[model samples]
Target: MTNSTWLKSADNRVKLLIFAFTILLLPFVALSFFTFPTTDDYCHTLTVNDMGYWAYQKHYWLTWSGRYIGTLISATQPLTYGSYFGYKVAPAILLLIYVHAFITFAKALSANKLPTWQTALLAFLMLFVFIAEMPSVAGYIYWYTGYYYTVADISTLYLLAYFFRHYPAITAQNIIVLSLGLILLIGMNEYTLVWLVILCGSLFFFKSIIDKKLHFKFLVLSLVALVFGVLSVTAPGNAARAESGLYPTPLKYNLLFSLKSSFTWEFHNLSKMAPALCVLTLVLIPIACILYTSRKPGEFGFFFVHPAFSLLVFAIALYLSYFPSYWSIAEPPNLRGQCVINFWTLIGWTFNVFVIIFWLLEKERIRPILSLGVLSWVVAFYFFSLYLSNFNYRSAWSDLLTGRAARYNKEMIARTELVLSTKEQQVTVPKLKNMPYTILNVTPDWDPAWASVEVNNGCAEWYFKKKFFYK
Candidate 1:
């Protein structure tokens, strides 16, 4: 075969692999949803299913839309197994929702100028937020409560992207639109809200000074958003929650401590994290190459010529995004919160990498060297993946991810049968073997023959609710 023909063939195969893997995503996620609830899952399920939603008793902004969204998922328990496909369809449905929403937003950002490959890479980046390969995949994207935040965040992103792209002068109609968008963004997470407020406001101020023109519309929007964020954070419910020691750490301490803890935690886990970093590096390197070749010279959007500013902004937002988690609690954030930080961290890391790449390309003297470096990166990434495939923990994590869905199918059946066939009103279920999908899982603590089955009936009762536990 000619060299060009051979290269084309390989490209086709790569595309095919991407397609098949994406197709595989649905069944994997669906299987997880089929399994029963884990630790906080049951509690959240009960609250959403049995109790009411949108109680001001819960934190107002934090829990408002999230409660409703989670309640929708919690309500799905009974039907999935008893009726239709149930939560088994969750992955695909969520994939389509998120992928479409993101791509649509991305198209708006690029003005539909980006190639399909780059767009697909963006979709893949979004997938990293979920998928078996990620840490706490089930918790962040599949659990009812976790999925609520995911949903809210997606909505927030969509709104922000749309509004930012279409930002205009203050007409009455535009004013309402801008105001509503700000409210929604602020409501998603106070930390993210604060981050954006500072990031966007600073950018606006700097741009105005540079351009010698004040943008009155964005200024008003920023002030209105500040008001919204303030009210949301200071809501009476926040004080009540803080009294429980949940929100005890003050904001000042949170910023300082979060910054300190992030470095400490990352440093401590450097060895353990190295392999995962390798995996991520491998995956991203090729995509970066593709991005470099496809986009024109200096076509980089925000990372244009001045990547230093972009890097600074990303670093600040990373700390701020992590601030709340570190601030309110002495301990580091649990897996759920960590997922958000990790996702942002990944974005920041990759963006910085691209910035370096851009810097190198901007220098005419190093084109040959840069091309050689790109080629080396791709080859090294392949070798790293090849090596990690056999490494103990990496292998285990991959195997666990692959085997989890099937395991869930088996356990759900056994648990269901055990609960259903009990002659007595109460019977304890055997403790379940742990699986990746079983985030925060706890099997019934019981003896082999006879254990107290306090939960024997609640399982059946909860079994009947509507359920789709994907973001």
Candidate 2:
């Protein structure tokens, strides 16, 4: 085929890939309609309603967690106003935001050489792998509390995109916007705070070295983010909560365990998902090559570091994310935390692979060997294997096709009705008969000894203004 014809064919194939990936994402979004509030949702609703928004924020800062933005979100959760529909639609909205941010970042990274639609196709592929490999779909995406982490995650992408689009000559407006964005990112959660500090610090260090001069803007941004991070970490609530026995591990043990478990979980998931990750890396190679070729000479100075240095930085950032959870909670990060880690893993790993490819391409001896036709077949085979092997997507489809999601929604509605209508202050509800994997089910069984039962019961009672229990 002629070069022009091949280029046109490649464009058409990318469009097709975009459509296919969109179709694959539909089940996850469709599952959102059946989502309901769970443990923390009820607790947050009751606390925020009782204390008022600002007071709730103060309460969390002084008594529970140092996540200032997180508390703000908790104070205004959709369920705070008894909007079940709002609750159900939140995950879908978050998913859309994530999609937009990823595409925007991709465009910026490629210096807008890639068409918007092609960037979107790239985003869809990454998001697909994220959903497929995430440790907890329901907790990380469906559950309101856990999914709030996505706000910071998405903001990070946008902030980086903004930086990439207007670096080294960032205007005053850009600085102000980026500073505010950094505060938002640092206050949402500790994991992202650490990641941001490291990211900005590393950029500041490397950019100075590459350009042979200081970059004051990055230094300013890093300082701003670090100040907020310090405020978050030093909040009285952190100490209070630590002593409250929620995290009973001693500091020594916590440190030791975190050191060991960080590497353990990282390697475990890396090994388990190697095949899928390899496929994703293969798909990203040509795209990365395109990005490398499109960049103006001497642009993105910090991005073209040696592969060994990039890998080391990636490993450090990844491990730091694990350390905060282990230190505070005396356990590995929960699935929600792992969700953030896994998302970053995919992103960072992809970038690291790109760095390697860029190094090879710069040498003029290496070129992408696979033809577009062959790559398309590989993409097709990937989705086929993904459909067959991805438990999260399979479970999502099962929940929808088997009517489990509908039944679960119906049952929750019935339970809510029972709570509202019963004249008696105390109400007993039946156990959930259909538990969909796509939705978080926080209803405790008959066993009161269950860890979350008391908290769930208390929140349910407060929210319903009645005594609530389940058989």
TM-score per candidate: 0.69, 0.91
TM-score, cand. 1: 0.69
Task: Report the number of backbone clashes for model 2.
Answer: 0
lDDT of 1 by residue, 113-215 (tens): 5556555545554453334334555566555445645655566557645653554323666757866766665665544466657665766676576668986
lDDT per residue as tens, model 2, 304-398: 77787788878898888877766766667777777777777887887788788888887776985433556767775877888777888888899
Which parts of model 1 are misplaced by more than 4 Å? 1-6, 9-14, 17-27, 49-51, 54-86, 101-111, 125-133, 156-182, 245-259, 266-301, 350-404, 413-426, 434-471
Consecutive 10-residue window with the lowest summed lDDT within model 2: 445-454
On lDDT, the candidate that comes out on top is 2
